[model samples]
Target chain A: MPTSLAPVSIDELKAIAKRIRAHIVEMVYEAQSGHPGGSLSAVELGVALYWNHLRVDPANPDDPDRDRFILSKGHATPFYYAVLAERGYFSTELLKGFRKLGSPLQGHPSMKALPGVEMSGGSLGQGLSFAIGHALAGRLEGREFRCWVMLGDGELNEGQVWEAAMAVPHFGLGERVIALVDRNGIQNDGFADQIMRTNPPAMFAGFGWKVIECDGHDMAAVDAALAEAERPDERPRVVVAHTVKGKGVSFMENNPGFHGKAPTREQVELALTEIAEGLA
Target chain B: MTQAASAAATREAYPYALIELVEQGVDVVAIDADLSVSTMGYQFGEKYPERWYTVGVAEQNMVGIAAGLAACGKTAFIASFAVFLPGRCFDQLRTSVAQPRGGLNVKCVASHGGITVGEDGMSAQAIEDLALATSLVPFDVVVPADFESAKQAIVAVGKTTRPAYVRTGRPKVPAVYGPDYRFELGKATVLRTGTDVTLVACGVMVRAALEAAELLAGEGVSARVLDMATVKPVDRESVIAAARETGAVVTAEEHQTTGGLGTAVARVLAETVPVPMSFVGVDRYGTSGKWDELLTYFDLTPARVAAAAREAISRKR
Candidate 1:
């Protein structure tokens, strides 16, 4: 059985997250067509998982018993590819090829194209079901690898997400699967609450999942929540990570305009400077 | 000319074939919606309860789950109504199963194809399933003609490692092929030979095309029959040969004319032979009725197919 890595100290994880955010900004700026707001918001969550929680080896990516991670909010490819690259699944140099025509880092995550990506995703509401697929397969094979899936708050509006929510508990896969909702509260057009109000914690709890809430940007809180999720229970677990749309850069933070827009070169420099200053 | 005395429903053979695969040591898992009893997935579940999954009425989730299972090195065979498998889960099929192309062996065997669904009406019948399944590039689409063929197709799909959509019917059509029939993917079976016209068909319509060939023979017109079981990656060699040998062609299926066998055959002929062709298929939505009445009402009968063949042969230049 694959084991999780030694927990990185909170400060070290925060620094790693800063570098990851820098990569996210640079990649999106280079591509000129990628989602940065959600990617930025998901920085700590991604860093914490790949660096500390997930039982994956950069050297042996295809290890059958390694923990699986799926980016259900697929538009956040900038964040996901950055985390994988930072963790040495591939070179961080490939981050520049994000969303390029021939790059393996497609605009959306594709499992066939990339070695580390667990499932192909772009259309919303499909990832949780796919996570359940991995969990179910693990249960049947008597494998100990855990499956983690991350979803955007607005993506919960898609009917298929609820369908999967209802199914996971019915199959009693609470212990094997852990879902994280990036509660950035923003979507493509506007605020998710304005578009379609979905009280996620209540919604998931109603569907019979054990719901946990935490500050998504706080490295320690997010780490603790993930740790709690792995504790065995009869119901599937979901961590409703409350986060800002863009956490590092002041201009883009809490701004829906940056949801699907790439950062300008100047904006990238500014975001990097802000992230660097925070590290200082 | 005598048809088989007792017909066997293709749905009836699904469970038996699945069980055979499981017993043969194939790492096969069956997933079904709430329609297991109707789709005949219950028998497989009853026998191998550990490998079967009943996902209630959610067809979209069923396909996604199947993709996940396939991702984990399990050959997942998912079954549902033909209308819901590709109809309800086309997007999931495209991204999760087809686009990844990781050798995800998710075989979707959809039952209740076409108006043969009988008395359940338009909502239950899936006339455009072939079109929908074929539109997803690189998907193997097969509509087997009878019980023997359905069983063989299922076992063949289990041995192969590609995503496939096998459309079966609710009605028990006459056995066109015997138990000794060998099923091959992407190859159309030539059932009869003639020079006047070629009658090409698939699904339940293959039996109609054979009976039509007999009807044409009675009228001094020689008609050939080709059972085009695989709709996608269609046997181009056989279709072109049929058009060239018999200067005209008639395509029949219990589906809409727009994207079914007729459209597939026409595309091939237009590219290769360019023969005069007539289509016999349902041009509109189906309604509640007996299977035979619906076939006649949709002009999907031996008489209509024979008429189309004669008309096509006359238009041959």
Candidate 2:
């Protein structure tokens, strides 16, 4: 599993998040096909989990007892790939090959294609159930490994999500499972609220889950919410991190146009410059 | 033909085998999306509560959870009516289970396969389940003819690491094989051999085919019988050899004529030896009735198989 707690400071995490944002921009720009808006929206959430909370080891990716992170909102592959690469699961150079043939970095996260990926997910609302499988198996095996899954707020439109939401607490798996929702408020067609208004906090709480809402772009708040998730409780925890559609880049922030579109070369340069300014 | 004087439901045999696997120390977990009584999966749950999960009436969630369990190193056996599995959760099965290369060790053994589900009506009968399951890559699809083969097939799939889909029926079928019969994943068992024509069948139709061979024998036509228990990764060599030797082939199943055993056999024959062929299966949706009544209603009887076999033989060049 993990060797020890994250040794990096808050400043280091911010720096890492900035670099991750840069990688996401460049990866989508090169692949010319990926979901960059959701990718950017989930950068800080990815950083907080990979750097501060999850008990995963890059070297021993297949360790049975390691904590698992499933991207339920799997369209955010650029974000997931950047996080895995930043965590030393694979080389950052491979980021250039995202969405290409023979590249381990598929447009969607595939478990067999990459070592760090815990589940193959592109179809939304299914990852949480898959995460539940890991948690149920851990309990059966008498292992203490925890499972973390990230879900998109708009992806809640799928009824299967509610099915899993109802199952986690029913199984008494609250102690070993945690879910993070990226409430970016923007789906592909339009704003999430305008498309399908599923109040995640109320919905999850009604399903008997412990809900934690935070500013997803704020690294410290994301870290704090994750820390709270680690506290012992009788209900499974959900950190509803409020995020922007295309965070970091000023032109794309809260813009649904960039949801699944790649940034042009000029847009990439501008996005990188904006990200570097955030680093400062 | 040897009548064993005993019969059992394939659905009943499935859970019996699951209990055996657990007793034999196979680390398997069973999941059902309600209908446990019909699928007979509740027996496994009642026996081993720790290793069983019933995910309400949600088939999609059940499939995803099963894939997850298998991915985490448990031989997860998810059960439901055949109509609910591939019928309601094809996307989950595709992305979560089958799309993964070398598939997860998940065994989807759905009961109530084909029109043999009987009184439940057309909605419950899964005529195209074999087509949906066999369409996936690296999935071992098997349809056991009788209780003994169903028992052995479940245990056989549990022992292997590959993903598989085994379709079983709700009705008590006549015994086609005894305790000495071994169930292999991709091998066809030749129940009887002859040179005039071949009768290939699966599930309850295997019994019908055997009876049909006897009828053909009475008419002075030497007919061969092959029990095609495994539909996907189908025994191509056996099918080709039968076609090459007999020059006529008639496939029988308690399923749709469009897909199921007929389409699988046609693919092999069309690629290898082109032979005169006919299919004796349900060509339309079925209605609510008794199991035997539906069999006659769909023309899935021994007489139908005999007539189809003769039709194929008459067309042989």
Candidate 3:
């Protein structure tokens, strides 16, 4: 069982987000293969969940009663792995092993390989269903622990995501499962709007989810959206955290090219400097 | 020789197995993809309404939800047509269930396996399910030959911790085993003993193999009949023994010759004792016809098996 830590201040969380962003830039740069833009965009959301909201113990990750978090948008693994490491699930030093051979931290999150990883993911549109599974299982076991899953805006293009979207509410797990869509508009090819247009808020609402919108990078807003998810409702809740694709680094910000490509070593140095200065 | 009074469909035994599992105080959950009636999931659903979930034509979600339920400590049994469950939702099975390495206890009970699905034709028949399922490293594949074995397989999955894929047929085939029959995972049951050739079969074709062995006995050819129900982690000991003892092998199934029981046996024989072998299965897609007619059309009959067995024997060194 994880002992509850004292509540972390929003400012402290913001500082932590900056550090997570720096780590993300460095890890992706060292591997020379990863998605940095989406990882940077999800920094604050991951920070908020791991630092303050999620009820999990790094030591006892398999605790049946612990809250579950699944990175359904698995390409943004730098954000997910950084948060787990920062939360003390594993060594922060292992971040350098991202996508390397024999590393537990693969390009995608693998539940079997990593301890804190609640589910293995890489293929999009599959995470929500996994979260629904955990939520339903929790309900069956009469456990109060909630399940939180994150989805990429472009990943919603998968028909399976909507299949899970329809199932969550039909199963009446509104109160138990909370979904977050990193509403970063860029995809691998180009802008999500240019490739495929999906109005997430309206679509989730249409699928019977209680929809909430927040500025993903804003610490307070992200926290508030997650707090609102705590309320027990008959319908599942979805937080559409609108954010920039490349949030911290000026060069990568809103850039589709950074969606999957890693930054050069010099670019990493500049991005680190920009993230460090952003804390000021 | 006497046969049982009536044939039993392994599909019919599925519901009763679920009822028994629930009565045994097993913490089981059943999930279906709108094919609950055809898959017989309604039997468990009616008895344990709270534990049953109908995912409504979404086989992918059905499999994913079942993986989740299994992850959270419920023994989840997911049911759909054999083709759709393993064929459509294979990724979920690979990543969420099998790859997790005992993280989830999900039983994939796929009904209507192989060309025996009858008039529904090639589209509905899961002739290659065994091959698809066996490809997954951690999944245990079982094609129960009769109602008793199907019931036992379900109960075994409930008690075990690993992920399993149990294939059941739509048609009612003759009962191959009695109530006293025990199902050991990854082990083959040798129904008859012989010396000249071996006939290995699974699912509906187990009966055909037995009849083929009898037909071979009339021609002074001693044929061995081994029912290899578990296809994934195949019973190597039995398969090797049959190969070494018989010198020739004939594998039969109500599936494609490439990836089902035939391939499983061939793999074992190729790696261990190389032998002259023939396969009695559908090498091509089946057409719309009566179940028995389709079997004949595919050359999956006792006559075919007997002929294959003779050919295999003649080719022996």
What are the root-mean-square deviations of the candidates from the true structure over C-alphas? 1.4, 1.5, 1.8
Q: Model 3: per-residue lDDT, tens digit, A28-131?
A: 98899999999999988889888778989888889999988988998899998998898899999999999999999999888758888878788788888988
After superposing candidate 2 on the true structure, give the runs of residues whose Cα lies further than 4 Å from its correct spot: B1-5
lDDT of 2 by residue, B20-124 (tens): 998899899999998998888888888898999999999999988898889888999999899998889989998899877568988999999999899989999
Give the fraction of native contacts in model 1: 0.64
Tens digits of per-residue lDDT, candidate 2, A219-246, equal 8989999999989898899999999888
lDDT of 1 by residue, A165-203 (tens): 999999988877789999999999899989999999999
lDDT of 3 by residue, B21-114 (tens): 8889888889989998999999888888988989898888887788888877788999999989899988888888877755468999999999
Worst 10 residues of 1 chain B by lDDT: B1-10
**DockQ of prediction 2:** 0.79
Q: What is the DockQ of each candidate?
A: 0.77, 0.79, 0.73
lDDT against the true structure, each candidate: 0.89, 0.90, 0.88
* TM-score of chain B as predicted in candidate 3: 0.96
| Model 3 lDDT, residue A79, Cα | 90
* Two-way lDDT contest, 2 vs 3, winner: 2
Models 1 onward score TM values of: 0.98, 0.98, 0.97
Between candidates 1 and 2, name the one with more favorable lDDT: 2
